[model samples]
Target: MTESDDIRSTLIDMLEELDDRLARITDDVKHTQEPLAKDSEEQAIPVENDEVLDYLGNSTRTETDQVNRAIAKLEQGHYENCEACGEHIAKERLEIVPFARLCVRCAEKSEE
Candidate 1:
């Protein structure tokens, strides 16, 4: 298969995995499978776990959005260009992070 096709497949797989994780996190945070403990002390553990799950859910959702955007860019024939500086993104970086929108330098700067 062509490189873009391979990358598209990888990104789709990542998106599916992230979606599954987000669903599980949502279910856990909502206590849908089991009710919260009646004992206050026992309840604290699940509450703390829910906080972590919430954070993970948010992170997964963000990644899912990025993957979707990357897929769109790939289809538009603009996937390899950095969003910030319009430079060509390194193939190595793309291999590692197919959903990345910025080059290393621009990404570093954005973190500041």
Candidate 2:
């Protein structure tokens, strides 16, 4: 297959995986909070579990958003360019984070 076609397939697979993981996280959060789902207080939830679930939920949501943006960029033919500086994003960075929107230099500058 062509490179563009391959990349498109990769993006689709990534999106599907993200969606699956997010759904699992949502279900876990719901299951864990089931005891208090209606203010019954019939059962106590563990503090550590709550914290873990909260963190997972937030990270999953953020990752999902990032993947969506990446898909959009891929569709628009701008996935290789940094969002902030229009520079080409490094291949290494893209390999590590396929959803990255900024080049390493621009990302560092933005952090400051």
Candidate 3:
């Protein structure tokens, strides 16, 4: 398959994995699979766990959105162009981060 096709496939897979993780996190936070602890003291653990799970779910959702955007860019024939500078993003960078929207320089600047 072509490189863009490969990247698109990888992004789709990543999106699916993120979606599954978010679903599990949501279910865990809601106590869908297991009931809360009966003991008041024991309840603290699950509550703390739920907080962490919520954070993970949020991050996962963000990544899912990025992947979806990348897929859209690929469809539009603009996946290789950095959103910030309109420069071509490196092939190696794209291989490593299929959802990347910025090239290395722009990405570094944004982080600063």
The TM-score that candidate 3 achieves is 0.88
Mark the 10 consecutive residues where model 1 has the least summed lDDT.
Answer: 32-41
lDDT of 2 by residue, 2-98 (tens): 7667767877788788788878877887777655645655445556777887898788778878878888898899999999999999988988888
List, residue by residue over 1-112, the lDDT tens digit for candidate 1: 9999999999999988998898888877767336756764665576677678878988998999999999999999999999999999999999999999999999999999
lDDT-better candidate, 1 vs 3? 1
C-alpha lDDT (0 to 100) for residue 58 of candidate 2: 85
The TM-score obtained by model 1 is 0.88
Residue-by-residue lDDT tens digits, candidate 3, 1-112: 9987788889989988998898888887777337756765666677678778878988998999999999999999999999999999998998888889999999999999
Would you list the C-alpha lDDT of every candidate in the order shown? 0.89, 0.82, 0.88
- C-alpha-based local distance difference test score of model 1: 0.89
Model 3 segments beyond 4 Å from truth? 32-40
By TM-score, highest first, what's the ranking?
1, 3, 2
| Candidate 2: segments with Cα more than 4 A from true spot | 36-45
**What local lDDT does model 2 show for residue 79?**
90
* Clash count for each candidate, listed in order shown: 0, 0, 0
Candidate 2 local distance difference test against the native: 0.82
Judging by lDDT against the true structure, name the best candidate.
1
